[model samples]
Target: MIIRRFSGIILLAASLAACNQPQGADDAAGKAAAEQPLTAVTATLPAVYYDSLQVTMSAYYQLSAALVKADTMGADMAAAALKYHLDSLPVARTGLDSSRVAQLAGQASGISAELEGMLIDKNGLDGRRLAFQMVSDQLYDLLRVTPLKNTAIFRQYCPMAFDNRGAHWLSDKTEIVNPYFGDEMLHCGSVTDTLRF
Candidate 1:
């Protein structure tokens, strides 16, 4: 009777141990799946969306690089270039429904206006950084729905950029060279998300 009781106890312990092992493996698997690249989120978009987006992103990179180098004039020129591309975005090029395209255009128009005003503002580098922040927020929304193909756009953040409220920008590269702080804290941000095309 004593041996039977001991055997029963051993069986119960083995079952409990087996149950715990699978749960741990499952948790690890879940994390691995969640960490995968965001490439699968993109859908087929119109050619104009891709072309204009690429041009606009290139202009943004120029502005970011200029800020990193602390060149206000360069930033101005880059912002102007970005504005030009933003204005040229074709509204009819979206494969999405008309309502969705209109929504996208509305957002794009907001970004353009901010960029144009920033170009005229004399508030200097601080003002420009703030303008860039607005542009980034709007552009991020637009890109979320119309992602580029075969490319990875990184959304980066700098917690120290604007009065400690934080700021975000998109980059084709993963390296962080903060535009808000310029050379004061050039590498002050990190890649928050990698949106792959």
Candidate 2:
């Protein structure tokens, strides 16, 4: 009877040890996983492409605002802005066929020409506004697709460029935070927010 009791106690202890061993191993694994750095996933867009897209979008908004206000000074500023943006477009051959690059550049050129006309003509407000809206719509549509393709590229290549710099687009007379590390919050509009005529 005593031998039976001793054997039972030894079996129970062994069972408990076996159970505890797995728990310890699991705990260690959990800790290791927690400590591991988040593996940076690739973005869909390259930094150059992403940045160019962002700049063009920003210029579109600015030009649209100028058109609505009939602010000649604003329009002039936007012309320079648009020119600068167009100049900054990524020209590097990123495996894209020449035909595709030419097509994109042609679209950009058309937008630039519209902006130049708006700036040059004193009475081109109505025509300018229409052109601005058309260009803005086209760019936004392109962006919807561009955002997905370049997501991994932008995240991996340009972390700062992916941040929200146009948060003020929804607010009425709100200050917009600069995306590229600036102290000033640019004063933007809620006009685009409503999408109303």
Candidate 3:
């Protein structure tokens, strides 16, 4: 009887230990993750495409920064550089897989067209900002399909831009620097999406 009693006590202690132990570590982890900011996930791209995108995004970032500072000439120059890179993209070059290059090239061509408009737009800074928005949209679409590894691209939106029509732009930073309003309203937007790979 004593042995049986001791066995029962041991079993009860085991049960109580388990009951007192942490029950939902996984649930807690999930909840923590849920509370965290979203990390944009996207399709992986080949090295060539990745390199090209990095270069293009670099120029686009420069253009955006220029606009944020209200530097019209700097923005124009950066746009020209971006155009050159887009134009020089070898969609069917040796070593690069031609299958995906055509599609990428098509998207890039559209971006180049938008940049051209920015280069020639005579409606002053507002016109250029509009053109930049178009370029940003194209880039955003392209990045959705082929995001570069180790890059964080923020998709920002401004409801007051374009006469309240609202607009979106991509930024390399998380801070809201309104390219549309420049110094007039430098921090006039919020990041709506993030693209990372």
Candidate 4:
């Protein structure tokens, strides 16, 4: 991801991806989150705004889990929820400088458009994956500015995605759940970066 200076340092969010479960994978995932519920953003924003962003992140995690399972219906549902959160983000109310606020707003807009593209009636599975790739990219940019409050977030990547064009996604865990290929290559990615907040 492109590194940008916010104040005097570069900004970032986390690393991740998740899809098809192996037996009790759901149990494991849930347990991990229960152990460390990263339910807020570090940005100085109103509580309601923070809750909105938290739900957005939750939806994104759901989308990733569905992708790992190659579950189209699930992905559709999660994408819709994500779109709502992205659209309603209250960036202006956040206690940040003009540049950072504008950056988050622009990225949120990009994320909304990408999620919409993913939900188009004719886009199908491949289209959804492609759109998710963009969403992941834009999310990465957005997270750079609006850091999530968590112990650690991993940035996962797969050079084989999109016919080797490559793709990246954020994860709360260190495991690799390749959303692009889902079950076919669920573990195809690797951790590229880790952010702790």
Candidate 3 achieves a global lDDT of: 0.76
Ranking of models by TM-score:
1, 4, 3, 2
lDDT of 1 at 66: 81
Best by TM-score: 1
Sliding window of 10 residues with minimal summed lDDT for model 4 = 12-21
Off by over 4 Å in 3: 1-44, 93-99
TM-score of each: 0.76, 0.46, 0.72, 0.73
| Cα lDDT for residue 96, candidate 4 | 71
Candidate 1 colliding pairs: none
lDDT (10s digit) by residue, model 2, range 126-145: 45544454455344333433
lDDT of 3 by residue, 75-148 (tens): 99999999998887655552435656666678789999989988886567778888998898788877776677
The weakest ten consecutive residues by lDDT in model 1 span: 15-24
Model 2 misplacement above 4 A = 1-43, 91-93, 141-145, 148-197
- Ranked candidates (lDDT, high to low): 1, 3, 4, 2
lDDT of 4 by residue, 1-197 (tens): 23345523421111122222121446446645664322334446677666777778888989988888888999999999999989888888887778767767877988998888778754778888888877876786566656666446787878667865567788888988888888776777778777666
Q: What lDDT does the true structure give each of the candidates?
A: 0.76, 0.45, 0.76, 0.73
